[model samples]
Target: MYKLLVIEDDVMMSDMLSMYMSGEGYEIKQAENGEQGLKLLEQFVPDVVLLDLMLPDWDGTELCIRMRQHSTVPIMIVSMKSEVSERVQALRAGADDYLCKPFSMHELSARVEALIRRARLMQPNAAGGQQEEAGQASEKEIKLDSERRLLLVRGTFVETTFSEFEIMKLFLTHPGKVFSREDLINAIRGFDSFVTDRAIDVHIVNLRRKVEKNPKEPHYIRTVWGVGYKYVTEVEATR
Candidate 1:
């Protein structure tokens, strides 16, 4: 079962979110204050966090920054404050997605599900038999920095666009996880709605143009015949 932690100071809203999310079949956990929230997080490593900005004890922005110090757990902010400055501040602090207050429970569910799915793509870049656990995805992200478009491909520093980096990171984090065009597009969409499956193919083409030793006859970014693409980690050794 997927786990979600809701950190909201408003008792009614917190209960409502918990009830609705629970109805959606998630294992819901709640905290009334940032302190309690952090305490709960120590014991419960959730797949996603639904955070409210205002709190009686500590601000959510500070908590977001603090969380980034130790975790790459996908955090989606649900807040009453709708100002652009506040939204930007939270995102800069490392919160992945921000949704304004009075959002539909269905929308909340959608965002939560999306974050978890995207986070899962960070495993399997191993080309052959061995594979890492889900938790290792976050550990690799700290060095990969997909948001900043930095990739550590076999210890080589490769720079690309944020979208390209996310694509590469997903492929590298999980070496052999086969993703279709739709799957990859959805994984990278996040708050941006301008992407299309054609766009994903275009990205693959561009990325192949950059990192492949022979972009014309690529080695690392291998097409899965009928499916999509995966980073071939063993390509370096095989070559």
Candidate 2:
């Protein structure tokens, strides 16, 4: 059975998710706040984390960043904050997926299962099998260290949240590919995620601020105009 850690302050919602996920054959561990959740992580490493944005003692995004520091466990943000900026902020904080409140229990179950499956596939086999790593196509000065989850721009390391790392990994690995808002959301989160298209724009905005020389006219990540966004890899692409 897959293990799930749910850190939600709302008693009713916590109970509901625990019960439903438990019925789906998952071993459920629930924490009322971020502190408790961190403590629980020490006791037992979970396969997936269902975190809330609002907690009495801690901010969810910060908690996520802390979690990503040690573990690559899949984290799904289940929160009431549905605004584009809010969603983008959570993603930038290190969340792997975002599911707005009032989400279907069935969909949540599916996402959790998917994360578990993906994680298993990426795990190195005990029989000495290994997964192939994606290589960068450009000789640009920027680099993303997947193992450390750090972005190095011109030799200066730029810290990034888990979600930001995922987004950048996608674009950097597949330069020149236009990823629509829906495509990006589905790739980072899940197909059933409730994040708005505007959230994608917001994430791109924040990403540009961190990696671009000029956010006004981005070079690394560019808008496709009426379509989506693409990553530019040409050595002369930068302003």
Candidate 3:
């Protein structure tokens, strides 16, 4: 069974989530504060984390960053803070998904399942067979190993978040195709996620910092003025 750690200060909300998700077959562990949440994170080592921003001891964004330092486990922020800035902050701090509070249990369940599914897909051994060769075209500067969910830029492996890797996979596979922010949002987080254009922009900026030789004047992923962004084809990258 998949494990889940819920870090929420609200007693009622915590219990409700625990009960509902327990029925969904997740082994549930609850923490009433951020300190306890961090402690449980180490001990429980859950498949997914359901975190709240308003913890008594620590800001959720800070906690998210701390957790990221230690583990790549998926974190879904479940909070009353619905502001785009708040969501951006959480995502920038390393959250894989964000769901505002007062949410439907069904939708929350779906998001949780998606996170776990994506996490599983990222595992090198999740496919349980001989690994396939890394996928690449004639472009010798960038390589994508989908079986291992790894990105190698110029022969060096660059660390990437799940969303960043997914975006790169899409861009590399369909070079020169423009993808709107909305399209990227759906591709990474699915249709049920609470994502904004700013979130996608933040992801793009972070990605550019990692893969681009000069983020200020990106050569691989270029902006399309008002529409969106696209990956440069081999010809464009060479030039």
All models, RMSD in angstroms: 5.5, 6.2, 6.3
Candidate 1 error regions (>4 Å): 81-92, 117-150, 154-162, 173-181, 197-219, 222-230, 234-239
**What lDDT tens digits, residue by residue, belong to model 2 across residues 1-239?**
88899999999999999999999998989999999999887787999999998999989888988887878788899988888787777766666678988999998988888788766754532112111112334444676765467888877899876556667877766668899888787766652255578877878888898888889988789899888999887453843
Task: Return whichever of 2 and 3 wins on lDDT.
Answer: 3
For residues 35-116, what per-residue lDDT tens digits would candidate 3 score against the true structure?
9988999999999999999988999999998998888888999999988788878876878788987999999999899888
Arrange candidates by TM-score, descending. Answer: 1, 3, 2
| Candidate 2: segments with Cα more than 4 A from true spot | 125-143, 146-148, 152-164, 167-186, 189-239
Give residue 41's error in model 1 in angstroms.
Answer: 0.9
For model 3, the superposed segments whose C-alpha errors exceed 4 Å read 125-152, 155-165, 169-185, 190-239
Per-candidate TM-score against the hidden true structure: 0.67, 0.63, 0.66
- Tens-digit lDDT track for model 1 on 1-239? 98888999999999999999899888989999998888777779888999999989888999988777777788999998888788768866778888998888888888888788767744333322233424344223223653443665445767766467667767766665688887787666764457887899899999887676678887667888788887665534255
Ranking by lDDT: 3, 2, 1
Could you tell me the lDDT of residue 194 within candidate 3? 58
Error of 3 at 191 (Å): 9.7
Model 1 RMSD to the real structure?
Answer: 5.5
